[model samples]
Every structure is written in structure tokens, then in C-alpha cells.
Target: MKIKLYCRRALMTLLFICALYTTISSISNITLADMKVWAERVQQETNHPSENSLKKSNLEQKTMNEQTYRPKTLEEAIDFDQYETATVLATGYTAGIESTGKTSEHPQYGITFSGVKVKRDLYSTIAADPDIFPIGTILFIPNYGYGVVADIGSAIKGNSIDLYYDTVDDVYSQWGKQELDVYIVEYGDGTLTEEALKALNEAEALQVFRQQYIEQ
Candidate 1:
């Protein structure tokens, strides 16, 4: 009977050991699964780039572009869109604007209503021979600010250009076929500065003018 009791106790001890083993195995499995999930989360965080990081990268690229910005080249600017070869331009302006016929028709632009589709603004517009200064040509006059080759005239032939005036008296009083310095801003594959681009963009007419100039 003692021996039988001892065997029964041994069997009970074996069952308890098995139960302990099962509990330990379950705990080990749960811990391993948790470790796997944690490792995967870590990997994802390491591999994926954050939204802020991407934005920062883009900002850096933009900064680099700004730091390296440059205007247009004269070598490229001198080549006319239509002309096979670029011609040397005369340095001075020799012409005058008279409000006659279509010139006095209606103002194209500016505060005052002076007739022609082009304006009377100094930097905004100018009249030139289509043969010499084609429409949409950007010019830089020394005393004058910036002007475009917007209109053509019979009297505006050759290198002579007609500056716009409010009245015929203003035309004769201001400039009566006098010589003034004139410069072409750009021609052919010219580039505009950021400020210049902003200015051009603000004006719809200038944008169209630039497009026509570029396409040519």
C-alpha cells in the first residue's frame, strides 16, 4: 500500500511538470510573436521616409535652384527669331510719334485713351518698322526703361522708332526725330530673370508677346 501511494504521488508530480511545461511553452510563443511584431514595426519606421522629410528634401532642392539662378545670355539673345543671321543694331534712336490716322484711333493700353492698339507708356510700348523691329521684340533703351516692339509705321522705317505721346504737341515737344540710345533686351533663345518673369506674368499681353517671341 505504501508503494502504491508513492507511485500515485509520482504520477501526480509528472502531471504537474507537464502542465508547467505547457504554460512555459505558451508564454514563450506569445513572447516570440510579440518580438516579431516589434521587430517589424522597427523595420517599417527605419525604411519609410516621413512626410516632413520629403518636404524638407524638396525645399532643399528649391533653395539650390535659387542659389544657382542666372539671367539670359547675349550670345543667345542677339539671334533674332526670324532672321537667319543676327544683325548688329544701331545704338541710337532717331524717330518721333505723331498721332495721325490709326495712331490717333484709340489707346491700346495705359491710363490715357490715345488710339493705336499699343500704349503710350514709355517702357510699355514703342512703334518701329516691322522690317527692323518686329512686334513682340523686347528692348532696353538707356534713358528709356524697358519697351517692346509693339507697333509698325511707314515713318517708323529703318532704325527710326516712334515713341508714343499723349498729343501731337507732346510728340513734337518731347522728341522731334531726335537721337536717343536704344537697346534690345533679348532675341532668339533669351531667358528672363525671376523678377522680370513675375512682371511679364502679371501682364497678359506681355506673356503673349513673349510666347510669340519665343516661338519665332
Candidate 2:
């Protein structure tokens, strides 16, 4: 009888241990899920919403559902401009990142430099070829460059270009307030199509920017 009782008590202990393990495992999974949700919410709140975010979310869902996610090939990624209004604006170094000791928010995203400092109100200048370049067109700088169209400048009225320098030292040493040639790549249909604008509007692009600021 004593041996029977001992066996029963041992069995009960084992069952309790198994239950504790399962509870711990469940709590761990919940914690991880909560962290992921928090990160996503932070991203949506900070960056402007756009098609990029939509695409990314779709990709994430596809990956979860289908177990795979792949980006477009280099050739597929290249967007060529075809609109008659499309123009090639002169390019220059984006100047502020390395100089300011800050990394780019989006390395793939490109912009024209308007001045040495980021203005109090995000004001800056671009090349004087707005007729060719237009105000809202986006361009890619090969390296050491970064920017977005926040505002235009009076002095930067024409084919002339402005370079961004994070600090006075950067202005003198790295940028030197010079003009450089920038290449404009065309993406999607000609004339800054709604799709292209939507692409720009996507949350992924803004999320990239937010990440940069957060790290800084």
C-alpha cells in the first residue's frame, strides 16, 4: 500500500511539472507577439503612410502564409522616366549624413542638396531646373547623399544647385558648397504616376527614416 501511494504521489509531481513547463512556453510566445505588435505600431505612427508600407505588410502576410519573400531583381527595380515633362536635374553630394555623424534613414532613397544646414523648418534648395526636374520629382544619388523635398529656396531658383552640410566644419571640409551632377532614374509610367507617388507615400520609406532618427 505504501509503495502504491508513493507511485501515485510521484505521478502527480510529474504532471505538475509538465503543466508548469507549458505555462512558461505559452507566456514566452505571448511576449514575443506583443513586442512585434508594439514595433509595428511605432512605425505606423512615425512615418507617412504610403504604398511601400502596404507592399511590405502584404509581403509579411505572404511570408507568414506562404513562407517566402523575395525582392525584385536589380533590373526589375530600376524605374525609368518616360514623361515629356520628365527632366534630368543636375546631381550633387547629399553632404549631411557622414558630416553630421548620422547615418542615412534610407540608403536607397535619394535627394538633391539645397544648403549647408537643414533649415529650422526643413527648408532647402534644389537645382534651378524645376521646369525640367519639377518640384515633386524624386531622384537617387549614387553615394554620400540624402534628402527629401521639404521646401524650395529663393537663391536656389534655377539650374544652380544647393548642397547639404550638417555642420559648418562639414560645409567647409566635405561639401564646400559645390554643385554636382545627379542622375534621375525613371520608375513606373511616365509623368510621376499615382503609383509612383503611392510608392513614395508608403510607410516603409518613412519607417526607414524613423529608424535612422531613433538610432541617432
Candidate 3:
């Protein structure tokens, strides 16, 4: 009988020890889970961009890259319109710099004239009345290179223009008086040409011309 009681007591003690160990293990598991959750929350609190923010930033950068800011050539200028103030669809003929070597000596704007300025003798120089074409205007001649309306001449009236030449040979040899298609690219105040037309409409000498050519 004594042996049986001893064996039974020992078995009960073992069972109690196992139960206590299980309880402790459960608590440790819960603590570990809580620690993991806290760590994840701290990570989120630190400075880090979310997936949505990263995507939006990338999209904005892409938009900027795709935008064409400034046009370098006439073909490129046609693709952009934000800088355009007025669009003139007209045709006329081209001449050379006036005689007496005036343009070569005293250039109006020093490599430029009126408000138009560019490098000396790099691109084809076109001169037009400031009242009509204004300074700082871009002209796209189909067969010719992109030219700036950087000068004016006394003979350059109505739709006439004088293209400058580096040498007298070029003046007489190539570009003397040739018909050209003029596309005037204007910017800034945007009202110069329109205002000039308004003034011409009120002129008495232009009455007949306005009815035939200017109005159209």
C-alpha cells in the first residue's frame, strides 16, 4: 500500500511541474508576439517613404522630363505654343542690308537691332519694321534657316524684309530679292501686331490697301 501511495504522489508532482512549464511557455510566446508588433510600429514611425509616395514622385519627374521647355529650331518652335504671342501667316520677298555700309558700322543693338539680339553673323539676319514684325520675333523660312527679325530698313515697308549678308559677294550672288514665306513668332505683351493693325485701319493712305491686303 505504501509503495502505491508513493508512486501516485510522484506522478502528481510531475504533472504539476509540466503544467507550470506549459503556462510559462505560453506567456513567453505572448511576450514575443507583442515585441514583434512593437518593433513593426517603430519601423513605421521612422522616416520612410510609402509605396504611394514613391510612385507619385516618379510620375512628377516623368512629367517634367517629357515637357519641352525651349525650342531651338523652327521645326521645334512649331511644336511649342506657350511662348508664342501672335501668329502671322504671310508671304513676301527678301532683300539684303542697306547700302553705305551702315549696318556693318552702327548696328542698332550691337550684333542685334531694336529689341532683337543674336550672335554676330551666325544665323541668317532678317530685318523688319518694329511696328509690323517687332523685335525679338522668330521667322521660319521653309527653305532657309531659322532667322530672327533683328533689324529694320526704310525700304522694308508693308511685307518687305531685308536679309543681311556677311560679304558683298553674298549680297549680290545669292540672296538679293527672293520671295519668301514669313512665319512671325512673337512673344511678350502679345498685342503689338494687333494694335498696329488697329492703327492701320484708321489710316487714310492705307484705306485702299486695307480693303485689299491688310484686312485679309
Candidate 4:
């Protein structure tokens, strides 16, 4: 009887140990499976970004472009648009007899063909062909700044323009002559004053000028 009881106790202890081992193995397997699934999810996210991340990248690029862009030229900086362009042979002149053939003693010595006194300081006086750029037209030259078409010359025809200077020295030293591309910023009313008509009145030119410009 004593031997049977001792054998039964040993059998129960063995069964308990087996049950504990089986439970530990199942827990380890479940933990390993969960870890594998988590690692795969991390790798997928690294390979392919979400739509929200792509949108954020695009926004950053657009902002960078805006910050880098800048205005290049004077016209662009001032937001001024050119009405037309011309390639001109530019010449400099002064109010003296050497340039305008009119002495200071003359009645219309410093007066322009458009009947206004020359504004030599601003370089706002230019002689152009009335047929091309009429009186009051405004132009922008690269090296010489701004000039207004306020005069005409017998020699200034076609794409030739004459810029005004305060002195003959300025004419030679500042700007002798140049071939340049000029911007026409604004056009004139195409109307000439009575004094302008008188100044431009060469017999043949007057007849044509009257028919084309004055009559209309």
C-alpha cells in the first residue's frame, strides 16, 4: 500500500510539469508572430510614402521657388510695359549752334520743335522722325536713360534719334554715338502745335505733313 501511494504522487507531479512546458511554448510562439507582423508594417511604410507626405513635399518645393524668384530688369522692377521697340542709331547734341544750328541769340534757340524749352538736365529731349515717333513720345535707352520726342531734325530720319546734353563737352564725352535697342514706353497724341508746324514746314514736307497728320 505504501509503494502504490508513492508511485501515484510521482505520476501527478510529472503531468503538472508537462502542462507548464506546453503553456510556455505556446506563449513564445504567439510573441514571435506578433513581432514579425510589426516589422513588415515598418518596412512597407519606409518603401512607399503616404499621400499626405507627398503633398507636404510638393508644398515645400513651391514655396522655395517663390522665395528664389526675382525681378531682373528696371522695367520689370517698376512694372512698366513697353509699347514698342526700335533699333536706333543714337547721337548726342546740345542747345548750341554746333548741334541745333541755333545760337543763344536766336528767338527759338533752346526751344524744341514741339514748342517746349529743352530739358537738358533730365536728358528729356530727343529729335526723331515725326512720321515714325510723333511729338510727345517717350522712350527708354539702355545707357542714356529716358528721352522724350520733342524735336525733329532734317538729318534725323528713320530709326535715328538725337539725345540732348547740357554742353558740347557732354555730347562728346558722355555719349558720342551708339547703335542700341530702345524701348518705347508711351506714344503721343500725334498733334502738333502751331509753332511745331512752322518749324517742320519745309515746302514738300509741309504739304505731306499737313495731308497726313494735320488734316486727319
The number of the candidate with the highest TM-score is 4
Better of 1 and 2 by TM-score: 1
Candidate 1 Cα outliers beyond 4 Å, as residue runs: 1-98, 102-116, 188-216
Q: Write the per-residue lDDT of candidate 1 for residues 1-216, one digit (tens) a residue.
A: 999999999999999998886798687765557768989977976799678777998999999997786333322333333433222322222222324443323453321121224343424456666666666566654333355655555556677765555455644454556565456655412222334434553565433234322321
What is the full ranking by TM-score, best candidate first?
4, 3, 1, 2
**Clash pairs (backbone) in predicted model 3:** none
Tell me the deviation in Å of residue 61 in model 3: 29
Q: Candidate 2: minimum summed lDDT over ten consecutive residues — where?
A: 115-124
lDDT of 4 at 106: 99
lDDT of candidates 1 onward, in order: 0.51, 0.43, 0.51, 0.74
Poorly placed runs, candidate 4 (over 4 Å): 1-76, 79-83, 121-123, 191-216
- Candidate 3, residue 78: Cα displacement in angstroms equals 6.7
Candidate 3, 2-82: lDDT as tens digits: 999999999999999988867876877655567689788768756686787789899998888878464444455344333
lDDT of 1 at 132: 65
Q: For candidate 2, lDDT tens digit of each residue in 1-216? A: 999999999999999988886787687755556768979988986785667778998988887876453322322233423322222233333435543334567542333332222321111223334544454444443222222332344555555544443445644554454344444443212133333334443446343333332221
Q: What is the TM-score (0 to 1) of candidate 2?
A: 0.31
Q: Higher TM-score: candidate 1 or 3?
A: 3
Please say which candidate is ahead in TM-score: 2 or 3.
Answer: 3
Model 3 root mean square deviation, Cα atoms: 15.9
Error of 3 at 113 (Å): 3.5
Whole-model lDDT for model 2 versus the true structure? 0.43
